[model samples]
Target chain A: MAQARQEDNATDAPPEALRAEGIVKRFGALTALSGVDLHLRKGEVLGLIGDNGAGKSTLIKTITGFHRPDEGQMYVDGEPVSLRSVAQARALGIETVFQDLALISELSVYHNMFLNSELTLKPFPLLDNRKMKERTKQYIDDMGVNIPSIDTQVGRLSGGQRQAIAVARSVYSNAKILLLDEPLAAMGAKEGAMILDLVQKLKNEGQVSIILIAHNYSHVFEVCDRVNLLQHGRISYDKPTSESSVEELTELVVAEYRKARTTS
Target chain B: MAKQAVGGDVGASESARSSPGLGSRVAELLLRQREASIFFVAIALAVYFQSSNSAFLSSGNIRSLSEFTYATAIISGGLVMLLICGEIDLSVGQAYGFAPIAMYLADQTLVLPVAVIVGLLATAVIGLINGVATVYLRVPSFIATLGMFFFLGGVNVILTDGFPKTAPSGSFLTEILGGADWSGIAWCLLIVLLMHILLNRTRWGLHTFATGGNPVGASEAGVKTAKIKVGNFMLCSALGGFAGVLDALRIGSIDPLAGGPNIMFFAVSAAVIGGTALAGGTGTIIGAFLGTVVLSIMQNGFSLQGVSAYTFNVILGIAILTAMTLNVYVGSLRRSGRV
Candidate 1:
């Protein structure tokens, strides 16, 4: 596996799996991402903290190829690239867990896991359902997630379970960079802890880099090796977990909030 | 370790508790219909008609109704996919009648099978246009298809000189296309069955549903919405054309004016009655089949009972309106998490 990744790493992100530098986006008069620069290192969980309109979503969307920036560039590794669409972003091993989780409610867990990347067999080119079910089960167990059945529809699962399933999908797809938008916001503490542990597990694997967007500073602090504060469509502060305390980050967030309020 | 064991036990029991019994499963298949209520109504109508008049369920009668249903339902299966994905194809009726008419014209002047293939291909091209206009050009499906309907309807009249040309009787290929056997069930039902499996079991089926459920989500998740919609448009139109040819063959004549405006409504009504929604995102192939069955049965029932043909339309309108109302209410309950 390591050797295979090394070969593929010719296109692999260097040190940082994903990077967005000088991103600028405008919607008529309002700017969504203004010269924001951020990068995620391999195997580290980087938290992005911001308010509702803090350009966090826009930045992530830009990085994931949902919205192209008006001016600026994005890099997957050290090599610069232009993401015209989400498919291009996915091809570069970037996967996103949207706030809505992008789950097809009526489909079973196994079916949802392979919605876009379906497992196919020869002759008829039909879906390989049995393999998908088995693979889904293995993934859940490998991640240490407890679910009753792989056949259960995502709609029926708890919020935490759904979040875990989404994260697991990215992991199973061999994603090198994961962008999770508020994955633990709706869950209780037990669920939150489970997700945190999963984050740690990914970090230990040393094959994945993550940019987790959250309003919960404590949760961010618990998991992230580095933290980036987004404000007014730009990165206002970037620091390692060891170098900066939560109190300093909180002050930075508040100061940015106040700045935006005054300017508006 | 003890705590973990207890948790595991609880999880197992939870699965057991929620697991439905065989009876309930059967009930779900029968009564708790996802959208197949329309088909049930068709069956009920058939039963009612048959009970009142022995001839109503006779092989001949069954065969005739099925042939009619086959052509209508095939076009409908494609429309269901379109409607599910938040698009409409108003040109299907005109396209339906015209494709076969083109084939007949070709058959009389040109070769035999070539005519049929040409008709199907022409319809597919129209479908391609509909798909491209709607998906790429960003024209709303209703306006685009409606415009196509006008254009095609005019084109058909011009080509036929206002009268449809007829193919020779007992042509081997036409006979098979319109063939009905021992029980009067048209061979077209086989096509419908094949379509059912394609729409329900394949990756294309999954993508179709996903596109309908949430196109934006589906697209972000890697589904090519444009390609799916366009491909669906061609499939729907092609089926319409195919149905038109089969209908002409079954009846032993081609009528440019026959199966006109009323055909699309029949297809849409069957689709809605089966459980597909105007809002898109929720429908099943079984539901569509059931809806077609219901309409057919109702028509059979009223006719066998010697009811006025005028009253049949009124009765159908009422039935459809009632079913759709119930469908909407049930859908709301599901959405609100009350179901």
Candidate 2:
């Protein structure tokens, strides 16, 4: 795996997996994202931090093709493309793990993993359950996602497990650019650590570029290679994680909060 | 990773150590499957009825029971699928009433095959209307199909002038459809088998589950939930109409008032009793067939015992309520993995 990653890096691969320039999204009279610029480098984890209503979700949706940006340019693997739907974005190897995880609770773990992209028996429309179950088990083992059984309903799993399954699904789908929207929200310490470890594992694999939208600064500092802060509908701060601290990030956000109080 | 390994090890050891008793294992199996419990109940009912009345298991009575079971089984086969996908067609019975009349009118001018096709198409149109109103126009299926129920019921009466029409007879197609004593049951079994495979083995079935379980999540996963639901509605109505035509051929007549709201109630009741959730996302076509069997047996058994017709309705009402209550409890157990 290490040799393959090295060979990939040595090849003429794009430096950046995804890049957005001057992205603007408007909802009626309100501008959710205005002149937003962001980039995720190849095989890098980029932490995106923002206050509530800071257009983090809007920006992520626009990138995922869930929402059309009124004005912007997006490049995947250094090639300019226009995405009109989530399906289009997925076709381009861009997958989003939404905050809700987008899993049918009533479905089994393997079924949830292969949702909308099911494997079928050749010459028949029947689901190839045996193949899917085997693949699902392998993927879960690869990601170190601990679940009692692949046949267990997704609703029976914990929040952290569900989150890991969602991430694993995106990874297994051959996602080149993954955007995780608040993956650790509402999770306990153990659960949050599990997701953090998964992210760290993905970072170590060095296969996919990830943009993790998070509120926790320490988590961002832990797994992210670089950090970007969204404020006033644009990236206001960008720095390598090595040069940044949780205190520095907190102070910047707090200062903005103080400024907002004074103005309002 | 180490923690996960330890957890797995602990789980394995715990299961190895327990080696649950046979009685507990059987309990676990039954508790885990709503279908199994219902199956045992149906068997027990059969045994009790056979012991009480010698005529209960006779060929003649069994044939009558099958006649009752076929309609419910076929109708609930489609209704259960629709319910699993979070939709319902309360007007299925109306479609059932409408199809035979449509087929009879078409037979006057067209060939038998063409007439049958026209009948099925007429019901498919009803389904399409229900699908469009519920999915595209954003009307709740309950209200939309309820309107269809009254409208189609009125149309059936107006078309037949509130009189029963004599059914066409002596054709091989008609004989195979439902004219033979065992033909209706055969068709019902075939439909149930096909529906069961469609639900368990097909992508469309999985998509239906996903759509009903979580529409937003299903859509996010790229499943066209609207299309799945609309397709289910169409299937439900078509099945209802097919069951109606079968009944018409068997009885050799078509009644404008036959298979009205009562048939819809019985079909939905059978589906629910068979373990199909009204809340959606979970169901079994085989279970629905068994549910129809249980209901038909009960109705047949009671009449064989010389029970009053009025008392049969009261008993059916209680049975439905009891089955539904049990279903909810069983569903909770399944979700919690207690079984």
- Which candidate wins on DockQ? 2
* lDDT tens per residue, model 2, A1-264: 534644575586638899999999999999999899998888889999999999999998899998988998999999998899999999999999999899999899999999999999989889999999999999999998788899999999999999999999999999999999999999999999999999989988889999999999988998997899999899999987878899998999999989989999
TM-score of each: 0.88, 0.95
Give the DockQ-based CAPRI class for model 1: acceptable
- The clash count for each model shown is 13, 0
State how far residue B214 of model 1 sits from its true place (Å).
1.0
| Cα lDDT, model 2, residue B77 | 92
Q: Where in model 2 is the C-alpha error above 4 Å?
A: A1-14, B1-22
**Which digits, one per residue and each the tens of the lDDT, describe model 1 over residues A1-264?**
533543464476447777778989998899998898887777778999988898888888888888988999888888899999888888899999997877877678998888889897888867889999999999999899888788876777878888899899988887889999998897899988988898889887878899989889888888887788887788888887767788998788677778879999
lDDT for model 2: 0.92
Cα lDDT over the full model 1: 0.81
What would the per-residue lDDT of candidate 2 be over residues B1-339, giving only the tens digit for each residue?
Answer: 999999999999899659988988888877777689789989999999999998999999999999999987999999998999888999999999999999999999999989998999999999999999999999999999999999999999999999999998899999999998899999999999898889989999999999999999999989999999889998999999999999999999999998988889999998998888899999889888898999899989998899988998999899889988887887788777665
